[model samples]
Target: MRRRKDKHHANHERWLVSYADFITLLFAFFVVMYATSKADQRKQAEAAAAINSAFQSLGLFQSATPTKQLQGATDAGSAPAATQDETVTPMNVVMGDQMLASPQVQEDFERIKRHLEGLLSNQIARHVVALRIGREGLIISLREAGFFDSGSAVPHPSSLATLGQIAEALRTTPYDIRIEGHTDNVPIHTDLFDSNWELSTARATHLARIFIVGHQFAPARLSASGYAEYHPTASNETADGRAQNRRVDIIVLPRVTTPASPAVHVPAAKPAAIAAAIPAPTATAEATARPLP
Candidate 1:
């Protein structure tokens, strides 16, 4: 008889607990997916912008110096054709080749080539004599035998006029100049030059000193270094290539910043150095370190 009376049961909303958990997980999943998608978009944009900027900067880019010439001028070398456009591709630009042709730098390789043709003609033109002049400045190259003696970094008397001519031109140009000395695969051992490296450096310094003292180049802008058999424009396999490799190179670059204040040596080099040092981080740095960071 008691079974007929159904006890009043409490309404349990236990299903809401599971529903809330599922909703919470869904929200978190959506948040994570949104973050990942946003990050991917930003990264792709950044990469696209970088590629675009590099193309714009380099003179080789069609936009920088457009040429329908490349339209038909598929690479004769190992590089592939510009098969696609609108999408960025490595074929659009070659980093190594782009570096060689600096926008601010005018490779006088052509002008120097012409000059050599007029002067040394076929003899030197067949070799790797080069001239690189640009924002970094200018470098005129001559092979060891072309400008010096066997196993010697000393300049031949005949080459003095050539060097003098370069210095004279640069006197009014006002760009800082460095004479970099290079040598071939052969190791030079002599009393005057401890090794080929020293010989190359000394020769470069020798020319630099002359340019500064005689031609009135700012001493601050002049420097010299010798790289013996380290940097070669050509191969060392053949005698002709070796001759080309054993040479001097000049480098010129633009001044990105103002000349540093002349060092006033006091009892300590610290005060001036400290004054010249870059300012430390400010309050803005902490603000940048946030969840958004």
Candidate 2:
């Protein structure tokens, strides 16, 4: 009788199953590691792209391109000391120290100047706005004619782009934005828009909207108002002066630990030439304020 070889097999191969199981575990571990590594790489790329898009859109960071002569800016840490006393010195130098400090603020201004030169050149430079940094912060101004069409509330496309750049530069910058819209003395009456009051109001709102909505700037830090044909920078007596009268200002305030402006209604000052707050003038005075362009 075939003495059933009593299953002499000592089940020596049972260890093979254990070994196979161990191999599977090791393979799975490597796969997980590889997947995690790839995921991390993807996340980094996405973050870089987002930052690039943001900077480029704001004109704060440009692609590889040559800077133009009109562009009057120096690097942040490399600007020469301020030498032009003729240039208006910042006031209440308080905010300057707390946030940007004078040197950094000046650097920002230079950057802005260079950016503006790239976009607008000197044709509008005389009318171009100034970015003033002080203890209170930055004061950005836009001559009305350069920003809007006569008697209309719509923003010129160029103005919108410039404003976009400005917004980007101030992103996360802690400075509050004050949008001030001013109009000339001429009575504005268009079929679509009724009066300078309405037009000016619309313009201010439009600029504010770009920051609040387009750029997602904080609404709490932003405010807007219209000076309907009231805050004239030049005498309204002449076309040139009247033209100079219109403008928009974006004031960037410094970090204020306490209540600052007893009132937020400071009148827009006259041209840089006069260096004083002046009233709207008659048409004749406006004419004489500037020679024919």
Candidate 3:
């Protein structure tokens, strides 16, 4: 019995150990994957919250909670019915409502219009000037016949008095003034100008300078632009229409809403000083007025 070594018995249970280890590792791997998925979901929620807060701060989104709730409800397949009152108003609509509700702005516009009508009665009757309330606020149109000679940027000597009067009236108001120069389609090539664009711009700048230097208007409150052969109030096919097209428009812009501060009172310039500051009319400027064809 000693001479014959006992034959080693084959152990069938040894494979069970490796199978148990494999099952444990598989369970652990699933646990780790579940934890990672949960963490990613939490991060995504935090990122969404941060983005919503930023948009809310910018006033681009009214409420973020509603959006999230809507998304959640949609995902759950039970979205709440929207009510008519819950409809979101556009930003432009709200701004328009606020502007319309401003009674002070309307009152100021009406007062200015009435005062200008009274002051410019004579010129209005002669068709040398016109005043109207437009979408852009008050528009005071100065016909070319009353201000500048044909193809000339220099204003007539008589026009300076009228301009001074107008400037005096406007100085008390806080609104900004925009001077726009316009020209007819008739092509122009002159010593001082190459085309209608140059002519129109020169006319606008000249008037702006008169306002800033002669009338002592605040430079910040003034702007100038030129539209040549375009933005025509009347057609360029006839003499009268062409004349109307070749005019300068003074537009008074509405006041902006801001924190209340003491209104600055600029002293009015004397009539004599204003006249002196204006450039003297040239001989060409004094030439007989002729309608542009």
Candidate 4:
């Protein structure tokens, strides 16, 4: 026999060492996955908390409980007086009282005015309607003859489309809208209405209903008032003046008091003057008011 080397033979079970290493590596991978999953959950919870905090700061909505911070997060103060060195004044509160009292809001109102003017250009040019920057943010004055019949609270059929357009334009705005009905000093007595007060109130209520029910405007943002003969843009001494007095005013109010600007007064023209200036259209049944017979 050849001389056999006495060197130690390699172990046949050495594959067990490789198998143990693989098991360890598999265990480590599962452990890492579990750790990563826990980290993801924590991050999601923190993100939700940050969103709630932001909403709270903006006064958007109420939360059920106070939000908790992440494990290592430090509280950061974003409020103006957190350090007590910043001077907060009463003017700040006053300014905050109105959401629309800012210069930016005023510019927005101007743009709206221009838009309205363009929309009602024909009526505006014919002097049947007037637009003014009043003590209120904006005033759109609609002549009675153009919208209603004499002593009637009902709007003319032709006026519906125009009123609908007006509602569409204003329903989306943030400003509060007040629809005011006014009548001439001349007393009105009809089966439907007792006096100017009743007539004006009915007219205002009618318009409000259209805005709320027809156009789906927010009831909270809309209001109706009847001034009767008390609040007139002109003296009700002449027929033209009376016609001017008999009008509806759509007032867009600012949320806060704005700086006063010079007001432009719109004068009322005489009925005869109006008729003479503008060609009279053919009399339509819709134009006639059902007056007391």
Candidate 5:
């Protein structure tokens, strides 16, 4: 008779191998997550440090020691105490809260205004030229009748002396000069100008050229622009109002300080080329004829 076969043993501990592997994988995942979190915190601290340095350089903060101590206190789980030396001035207050120009700039504008008024007394009295402190710094308005002929970009021969005097006065200033040309609501078309856009731009560019070529003004300090029947100073319904609207403005811009950066110089287009590129006005009749209240 054959001997009884040995009893088969069922193993219960085979599942322990799989359980150990799962536990190891879970630990490794948590370790990776902790390392990533620490790296993010490090990056955040670096960015904050950079920003603090910039603010300190701008004179917004009195001292850098306080910022470093504050950061350390924060990391140590403590509230940072405010101190007199750590006070930060508001940016608005530092930059003049209410006025656009500084005290010195305002004084300079006043001086220039007085000088021009004295020299242009006759023109000012005749309403051919006006000087005022406008929102855009000092505005010297030159009416079309005094500076240029009707529908002509060229200044009258008699006006050259006046323009020369004005240029001479401005030549001493350090501020930038912007020559702005304006027109009335009346539409225009001619051999030289196709629309008010061309006429206005041509007038402004011509004045700019005279300042640069004739009076030896710095080209970098001069800019020209044209507003065709838009940005009107008075109503277009009356002749006197229209006369005021048709004018060229010489604006003295306020000086501003900014952080240095790399500059890219681009060649400026000629006035004629710019005018040709500008699209014609497409205002409807209702909008164009609407009277100012």
Candidate 6:
């Protein structure tokens, strides 16, 4: 057999790979540059107009007294009279009109905070109970160590008095109450609780029951949710952080005041008046949905 001649094939397509990669990189660079460019002026104006309209429609903006009156008050150095006219317009108005964004509601909220602070001074000093006024509303955080035992949903007997005090303070308010339960990232399995979800829900439900059954809070205004290590305020990698994450938060809904906004007139209604004005209770224990973990 004849010896096979060695054949050499010259490759011409080797450079295409590098060229394609370069084109892809160039396209990505231009895309990034375009994405970072300033937005169009017309678009910005439209966005601003839309936001203002939405706020107005939602009644989030309350117009204060005229500029002349404000100037007069400033010159006189005396507080101007409150402009909030407690005149509920037509009954067809939205329920948002009765929200806790008025001066009276703010006073009530402050009064509640002061009373609770005085009653739970020891717990507050021990860092077991923390009170904060956030945009959502007033938040009362109860640390697990001070409220519940490990793997247990029932709060300690010693903390019952504090809870009772809190209930009494809020008994007369018409704002809705939301009880939230959170846990650390550590996985827990017990006979009573199969997972953190069950544990957290049980804890929140038990606390809500205290308010509903023990304190006779209106079931319509009270609700509960279990976050189950999903809404931690601190890192779960450290001991102290985990401790901080595992807690219960009671959020009073519809902020009483927006310190960021100008002083404006917004009417408020008392609990009894609100109860009479508002329709029947719409919120129920069975209506609350359990979010997937």
User: lDDT per residue, candidate 3, 50-84, as tens digits?
Assistant: 77556533333323134453234246756555444
Best-fitting candidate, scored by TM-score: 3
Clashing pairs in 4: 98-256
Candidate 4, residues 1-293: lDDT per residue as tens digits? 99988998889999999999999999999999999999999888988777755654433232323455576676466332232222111111112223324565577678888988889898888888898865545788889999898877767767876776677788667666778888899988666676777777667767776676666665656668777888888988889999899999988765422213322323433333322343222223122122332
Error of 5 at 152 (Å): 0.4
TM-score of 4: 0.54
User: Whole-model lDDT, candidate 4?
Assistant: 0.67
- The list of candidate 1 runs beyond 4 A from truth reads 1-23, 26-128, 132-138, 256-293
Residue 280: error of model 6 in Å?
30
Q: Estimate the lDDT of model 2.
A: 0.56
Local distance difference test values of all predictions, in order: 0.54, 0.56, 0.70, 0.67, 0.71, 0.67
1-293 in candidate 5: lDDT tens per residue? Answer: 99999999999999999999999999999999999999999888878767766754444322313455334435676654544422332221122233245666678889999999999999999999999875556889999999888998777657777787788898778777888888999999876777777778777877887776666676766778788798799999999999999999998766322213322434444434433443332332111111223
For model 1, the local distance difference test gives 0.54
Clash count for candidate 5 is: 0
Clashes of each: 8, 18, 0, 1, 0, 0
lDDT tens readout by residue for model 2, 124-231: 567666544443345566776666666656666656666666676765464456677777887866564565666666667677766665666656567677777776
Candidate 6 per-residue C-alpha lDDT over 127-206 given as tens digits, one digit per residue, 9 for 90 to 100: 98999765556789999999888878777666777777787687667666788889999998766666677777777877
Question: Which has the better lDDT: candidate 2, or candidate 5?
Answer: 5
lDDT of 1 by residue, 115-139 (tens): 5445544434655345544323345
